[model samples]
Target chain A: MIDRLTAFVDRLRQVGVPVSTSEVIDASTALSFISWSERSVFRSALAATLIKNGTHRPVFETLFDIYFPQMVGELQQEPDSEQPSSKNDAKPLDDMTSEVLEALLRMDLELLDRLAEEAIARYAGMMPGRPVGGRYYQWKVEQALDMNAITERLTQMLGGSGPGGETAGSVLTALLAREDATARMGELRRRIERIIRGRLISDRGPEAMARALSRPLPEEVEFLQATSEDLAEMKRTIAAMSRRLAARLAYKHHRTKRGRIDFRKTIRRSLETGGTPLEPKYRHRTNRPDLIVMCDVSGSVASFSRFALSLLYALSQHFRKIRSFAFVDAIDEVTHFFEQAEMEEAARRVRTEANVVWLDGHSDYGHAFSQFLQRYGDALSPKTTVLVLGDARSNFRDPLAERLHEIRDRVRKLYFLNPEPHRHWDTGDSIVSKYSPVCDGVFEVRNLRQLAQFIERIG
Target chain B: MFESPDRVTAALKKGGYLSDAEIATSVFVADSIGKPLLIEGPAGVGKTELAKCLAEALPARLIRLQCYEGLDESKALYEWNYRKQLLRIQADENKDWSKTEEDIFSEDYLLGRPLLDAIRSSDPVLLLIDEVDRLDLEAEALMLEVLSDWQVSIPEFGVIRAQRRPWVVLTSNATRELSEALKRRCVFLALEYPSIEREKEILMTKVPDMPEALAERVAEVVRAVRNLELKKSPSIAESIDWARSLIALGRDSLEDGEIAETLGVLLKHSVDIDKARGALTAK
Candidate 1:
């Protein structure tokens, strides 16, 4: 049991979930207390001990299903006792099956899809016993469809000049003429494989399916193209990163600074050593600089804004005060929104209700800067650090370089985070170069790694 | 020590804390192995309540150390009573210097903090270190040392091992990530908001005088409010308070206007209250 638990932990670690040795021991101990027969109870026990962050729950569940499969017991109830005899049924080649074969032979992808569902269901039932894996099941289904034979039939039809063969010949000829026939074949193979895999998942469970569909590393996933699930996973990663950053900052401050020396205590200690002075202490300073975050929450850079705001919000405790603003063409003071709601909720509300996006639906950095200077300019001081997150694409409008320069002069530092790659920054509508000259630092933060490096440098 | 998870559940329930199978299993395992249990969750999910309940169930002395920023070993573990030591040194001035010095640094001059007290206690102890995430990394390191070894190493008096292994429960709101070293030395339990059914039971138990329908309505509303993106969702404790408030007002079922009026009992922030009000009105 310990070995199994350790192995499961190892898998979790492989999938980027950090699990300590003590956690492994705790999970094993926790397992001993639960009735192992109750799978949900057992799963929850291990999960509570193994998973520290909520984001890791999905990965942990996937790994759990893989390591401790409940399918073996489940499959026994409805055992596939029938032998693998393709010729046992009189209508062995059902109407849908024959149509699928015919469509494959004729290179009719549309018709093939129409019949593929029924064909897959029939093929799944015929395959006795638990599937070895998704890939093997895919291969079995492909073999049952006889893809090679269909390819050969198509080739033969293309080679012939017989009656009714001309139509098939033209279709096969057109398919062969395409430069991406191999790619098309690969797509078709994948589609069939998905059908087979989907059916197998219902029988065995989603664990095998999830294992087959690998996810990109959290730090590597691009923000703009990320799905909601990826965004959620990134949020967890950001949360963990922020916690570590806070701890690091606290440790640094704790190590570098000392509390004020107690003169009375020093004198009292001196009495023990005959008026010898030693062990001086200095006051612990809790002073943190004010932070002002200006984010671009327009269509192009919303993901980056969300992530940056969340990270900043998580570290809000470390700062004296953090005022956040979101803008496209207009600016809205979202500091209160963030302060009033949780990070997730605040981000959502900012998107929906902050009214940062103008009716024109185009990002106007010049307008946003002028608005910020007009309304919240007094809030800036020499002690404040202004952080801006945007792609700097202002739709060919006036580049508000001078307004930013004025704000930069008032603030201690102005750091701009551009989600676009550096190569594309100066091109198109992006006026990053215009603002880069006036800003203290312009970091091309395309992913979390760059974001982390930038954050560390600033800290 | 719990013989099974069910026994742990029964004991905790009898102590007025409705625990699920996972919590029961974790508590039982921590007791059986004599290791500390680290409970982490969002704020007000009863991470601290679990410790209190376990202490009540075990019928042991509950020694609590509420952690915060700048929490040091002197405050959490042990501190030498310097003034007492100094006075004793002055009083023993005529005596041999080394003898007096040694005497002043002994256990008599050592003021035991929560950790030291739990370790030295002969009675069964449930040491609840609340909000462990608030402690600085240095303080956390100090705690890790004592928790892992079940002993504190004082330079003058040497190591003081626990007479009996205390049932330690460290709770964190996850404001910060705890060090792996501290986490590894304990059993881990992640407590979340209870399900509606479990929460209803909790509301009823915590507010027995409240009507059953009112309790169910409070649980349902609290559940709905939690689902909304609120700044601070009503915790189980707040749900009980909400139920009690409703009972005090002579209301058996939640009314439309009253929900808007009484949302303050459940939600702390005005923004959250507004959001909950909007959601309730929309429903």
Candidate 2:
């Protein structure tokens, strides 16, 4: 049994999840409390046993569901059946599962697994969903059949208008070419069509039953850009390394002085000085960066501000000065966030501290641009490099194209990194189409990989 | 010690450069501190190679522990030699049944796996704990005590401490983030994909038979193709493969014309091949 559990986990590893041994112990301990006589309950119990944190809860639940699927009758509205009930309509999802289970129990095990899958899939398709324009008639016909063997009852209900008015069987035959694994999956998939509920997973992704048999979630983290301090440190380190002279620097040039001066350096310096009486001056050097950065940490783009701070922290040693600011409806200097004892805490304080009336959390770039013009347009000189990270969605407010036009004149380069996809640029409050024109460079950065490329390009 | 990012790149320029960086250099430090090194990287980025190379550098025997899900101390440490135990049991069956249980559980019956094998070996060994991510948390936690002490406890043997604590190297593709408890015990190194220049150097070195110009073109094509939205990008191994495939085919320049069927050389996934094919023909 331990070996079986071990094999079970080994399979989970074969997928993407990393399971440690303590979790296995916790799962086994949890399993001891359950009665395996009931498979669904036992499955839930095993999940309860193995998984510890809330973060891993969904993953464990998914794995559990995949491993020990409830048989048709087993999935009935008993105490622990995993049949998901819609908040609106409570009862009887798997009438077919129970019907097939009742029909198949004590029958052939292989046949039971097969037909139950078919009937369960069919039942799954009829599960509640929003009205698809074409599927309404099919749903209605199915609803009729479900209501009063409505396939048969439709004739009387229709007052003999037309007998051939899309029978359920003909509708099924006409639509979705349902056959073999495609038919099975098509049925299963239609049953588990993606929820519009705005969540990462619904019970609909592929191999749900297989994923459910395990303990917890898979690992997926992308590290494209470092936290701001780390980025800053990398920048600083790179700068410091740059000055060492990859091959050689003529630092020890000879100097030939008047009366018995240095021999080697005296002669070398004399050559540069036409072998005249000259002195060799030694100046120690380390690589460093000479540049200016204009960062926009406005509340609209606050999600990345934390990382920006870390970058600033890392580069604190390399640069002479870094001029940073935050804006909501308006731009305000908030470089003090990096200077503060706690960067996150400071950002919070700044958010509250500078809650000026114009600076709204929801974006208003027109006002922000106008404020930049009146307040600090002179600061965006040609030597400065401006990096703006935001959705560029100004919420249907004025696009304020003229102000960006003026600021573009002052800054040497303006780079834009929008988190939103390119297609969504002109959709709603998005000023991406308008803003893309003024910026020197524009790139979509939805993940770390893109961000790393962006940083490398800029650096 | 890896001072410049360029130095790291330069280090990776050679052929057989394993992408085996841990969570931080702490793993490197721990290895230097004479503790076991736990290295976790994706499947093909060469976690095992780091140990192999390090073993070569150190000139020590590489003792590897291949971890599976249900890995236990009995398997990782020492297990009773059942054939020997059974032979003894049969031999002692008629002599004295009373002392049979104790006699059968003696050290003579114990057989050593990698963990115990590393401990008992007179010479220094590189104990590679490959794919630590596959093992459950309990196994990881159990590993902590041994990792710190360089010893294993067996009731039969009383305690089997390392005669010469082997250099332990653990690897993972990050199926899960290791616990802080386990992490604190080791040094770290986070391996990332190499840059274009470094990758080019790697290609030239790994496939020395490859034409230099062809290798450069391949690296460029790989980088450019990688820039597009594909299912998965070509890894370092894939770069080597594409070079080898090209070399075997006796092709030097990657003509725009050759990309259609030769896309299988670049893209691994069918969808990616189709996407690349579409892009190649798009203009």
The number of the candidate with the highest lDDT is: 1
- CA lDDT, candidate 2, residue B56: 63
Q: Per-residue lDDT of A98-217 in model 1, one digit per residue for the tens?
A: 565467556687776645544454464435345466566566666777766544444444435443434333332333322123333555675666455444555555545556644655
Poorest lDDT segment (10 consecutive residues) of candidate 1 chain A: A171-180
Candidate 2 local lDDT, residue A190: 34
Cα lDDT tens digits, model 2, B1-283, are 3332233323543325533222123223343344454554434455676667666655578878887665777667677766666677777878877588787777667888888788788986778888886666677787886787888887655887878777777777554546656754554443445655666777887896877777766776666566544445667777788888888888877755565657786677775677566544433
TM-score for chain A in each prediction: 0.56, 0.40
Quality of model 1 by C-alpha lDDT: 0.73
lDDT of each: 0.73, 0.53
> lDDT of candidate 2?
0.53
User: Candidate 1: deviation at residue B104, Å?
Assistant: 1.9
